[model samples]
Target chain A: MASKLGIIAGGGEFPGLVIAACRADGRPFHVLGLTGHADPKIIGDAPADWIRLGEAGTGFKLLKEAGVAEIVMIGPVRRPTLKELAPDWRTTKFFARVGLKALGDDGLLRAVAKEIESEGFTVVGIDSVLADCLAVAGPYGGLVPDDQAQSDILRAWEVAKGIGALDVGQAVVVQQGIVLGVEAVEGTDSLIRRCAELKREGPGGVLVKVRKPGQDRRLDLPTIGLATLREAAAAGLRGIVVQAGGALVLGREAIGAEADRLGLFVLGREDAC
Target chain B: MASKLGIIAGGGEFPGLVIAACRADGRPFHVLGLTGHADPKIIGDAPADWIRLGEAGTGFKLLKEAGVAEIVMIGPVRRPTLKELAPDWRTTKFFARVGLKALGDDGLLRAVAKEIESEGFTVVGIDSVLADCLAVAGPYGGLVPDDQAQSDILRAWEVAKGIGALDVGQAVVVQQGIVLGVEAVEGTDSLIRRCAELKREGPGGVLVKVRKPGQDRRLDLPTIGLATLREAAAAGLRGIVVQAGGALVLGREAIGAEADRLGLFVLGREDAC
Candidate 1:
């Protein structure tokens, strides 16, 4: 009998990738794909079950019925517009009992994770299954960051880490040692685009994205891919720095090739700050 | 003899309004109007001298020539785009030596003020000449915020202050205890517009603008006007809260009338935080 695993899929290609990895490793898995964010094609390709983004109650029931003991959560869930995702009676009652104060990304995710575990299923980080996908240090692709770019990266690294430590956001855009923009709700791509528009009068800047210090890795891990690189190029960004061993690199080879083609530097550095 | 004041004008009606207030009080003033940002019509009407934004070094020379001993900076100078204003050798040297440490608006303006004062002129806050323009605590318009909106304002007040303390920015948009957005370099109007877009998926929010705790009141006092209220309406915001006794209110009558017409609440609170 095959060893069974449960996958809690959010948005993006991460869930499908994980499913493929598991299949190649001969590990049987059932997926709980979110309705709006998850790709419908994933259901056909991966061994899985599916549910809507806010169908947490039903998701729990299906997982229990599958007799799943261990579960791995993966993919990006479209951050619910909190008002639209009014919790069902069960979730509302749970929240009422807990009376949480903060509702930041981490706080909400941790609460949701706890609720999942409270239902008697183990919540595992995706890294447990795809450790190989974690980004490595040093330059990626043919274009290595120059000395000046490296200095900017270091400066931005410290600033970004300070922001993260404050529990704000994990990404900042810098050029010539001046911050062009900081990420809040708009996400990285939008921030990068705004930086580009703001810097239209000067040379484009660098994007530094890292996992927040003490960030719970089970949910909302720092992620980048070919699309990210493409957006950065479109936004006239010179390069990007991702925290080594702290981010997931999707389509690594393609991202590398694109960065080289665009004369963009992609570097992964250890969390120095 | 009337008290002689020097006004450093940026864009908008701020400089004109300041001049009107001074004139009404029988205070004689000369204005150094920023070319790109200040309306030429207002400059012609105001009792002052004029200069281009890029002519900062020469602007000081003109100010000295005007026999200006006490100077008041007012209005919004278009933040110079990197390409548009190449700081002359003196300005370049100043920036190079200053380096990349974060300087909040007050710090930057104060440093600039000191640079001017070092050349033998006192840079004064607008309050020195037009104290009556400062906003007071109370409803300035017909629509008063209800208890629910007031609670949201209070919640946003804390968040906005925290953000301001970080020296990131001065405004935040919140609704029902959820922060929809925080301003950082993007400025308030754009921030509100973004929040409005997000509100399509969530509860319409309230905007909170406040002075940073320990902020140098001599410079960077938060200000709002008719355009701000119009922007808030465009962004679907229901109300606005500004720091009482710390905020400058320009076009008060027009702004008040517009806010009343739109049924938008405009409240000013003491900057206790």
Candidate 2:
């Protein structure tokens, strides 16, 4: 009998990838994909269950009923907006227990994970099954970082790490030892746009993204892809530095090609400095 | 003979207040206020020379030739867009020599100040002249922060100070120990508004603004006013914590009244934190 795996899909192609990787490993997988966040294509290709983002109680019940003893959470959920995701009685009770007045993305997610784990299922890191997707060290494509761009990358990397240490966020935009922006809950894409606005007439700066120190790799992994490359080019960014083996390279080949075309250096550095 | 002081005014009522304080002290004061940023009302009330923001080179020459040995940079200058500031030959030469790819607000101001000081004038802290305008420690109005809000304030304060240490602005918007945003060149009002967007439908969080660690208060002292109070209320913020003696309070009576009405806690903690 094959081992059955439970996957909590958020948004994006990550869910589909996780399913494919599990099947390739000959493991039977059950998925709980989020509505409006998970790719519809994932539903057709992967054998899985589904739930809306706010239906946490239903998700828990379904996972438990399926005899899911271990689970993995993956993909990006649409961020909880003020109108959407009014907590159900179970969730409200759970929140009451945590007692935080203003819960942010991390806080909310951690709370939900705790509630799910309380039901007896062990939550596992998504990377444990998809480790092959981790980015390698050094430049990804034909483009190489010049010494000047490399210096900016190192400086940005240091600042990004500091931000992570503070548990603020994992990314920072820097040029000439000055921070253009730091990623908070707003995420990297918006940060890139803001950096573009600040450096409107220049070649832009280096964007360094890394996993927070001691971050749970199962969730909150830094991710970059072709869309990221396109956005960086749009923002006039000269390059990007992501932590090697610490981030997911979604659409790695396409992103590399795009970076090469845009003359943007997309390098993965192993040292999480 | 009284010491004749030169005031380089920016925008806001700060210049007007400084002028009034100088007159009350019977000090000889002159102003070189920026056009498009400085209030025209300031020109009538303040006895000072006025000039456009980008015409700093000429302004410095005039102040130096007037035998002004000490200068105070005051008021809020509308941050100049790169296109708006048409740099003259001297400004271009200075930028070329500095080899800085991006000049943020602080960097630009520091460079201009360096040029002025090289010509023999000392840049004085605005606080040195208007000590009475400094905020006092403890709650100002009827609204004392609850324990939860106080914890949030302490958390936001530490993060704000860290941001200051980086010389990347001096304000942070935080909620439940999570930083919603860090002020860069965007300034505090916008920073508060951005945090509002991320708020999870609660009383909102605290806005913490402080003098940058080791900052030369001669330029860019943190400031709040009636407008700041209105912005905070609009952004759903519960309170504001500013570094006492390290920040300027404008429209104090009106601001206190509004804070009282809005149930917003406005406190100026001592700079020791």
Cα lDDT listed for each candidate: 0.75, 0.77
For model 1, the superposed segments whose C-alpha errors exceed 4 Å read: A1-3, A81-83, A100-105, A146-155, A162-168, B47-50, B81-83, B89-93, B96-106, B142-151, B200-202, B251-254
lDDT computed for candidate 1:
0.75
Candidate 2 segments exceeding 4 Å error: A23-26, A34-47, A50-61, A77-122, A146-148, A175-177, B23-26, B34-57, B76-118
TM-score of 1: 0.90
Name the top TM-score candidate: 1
Worst 10 residues of 1 chain A by lDDT: A97-106
Which tens-of-lDDT digit does each residue in B6-66 have in candidate 2? 8888878788888888889898878887878788786685656767665767887778766
Leading candidate by DockQ: 1
lDDT tens digits, residues B171-226, model 1? 88876555677776667887887777666454467988998777766676778888
Docking quality level of the chain pair in candidate 1: acceptable
lDDT of 2 by residue, A1-273 (tens): 545788888776778887888778888778888877777786566767777665768888888777777788888764554345576666667767875443543555666677778888887877677776687888887887777677778767876776776667888887655677888777788889878877634445889899888676667688887778889988888888889888888767777788889889898899744
lDDT of 2 at A53: 66
Shift of residue B135 alpha carbon in model 1, Å:
3.2
Model 2 Cα displacement at B263 (Å)? Answer: 4.0
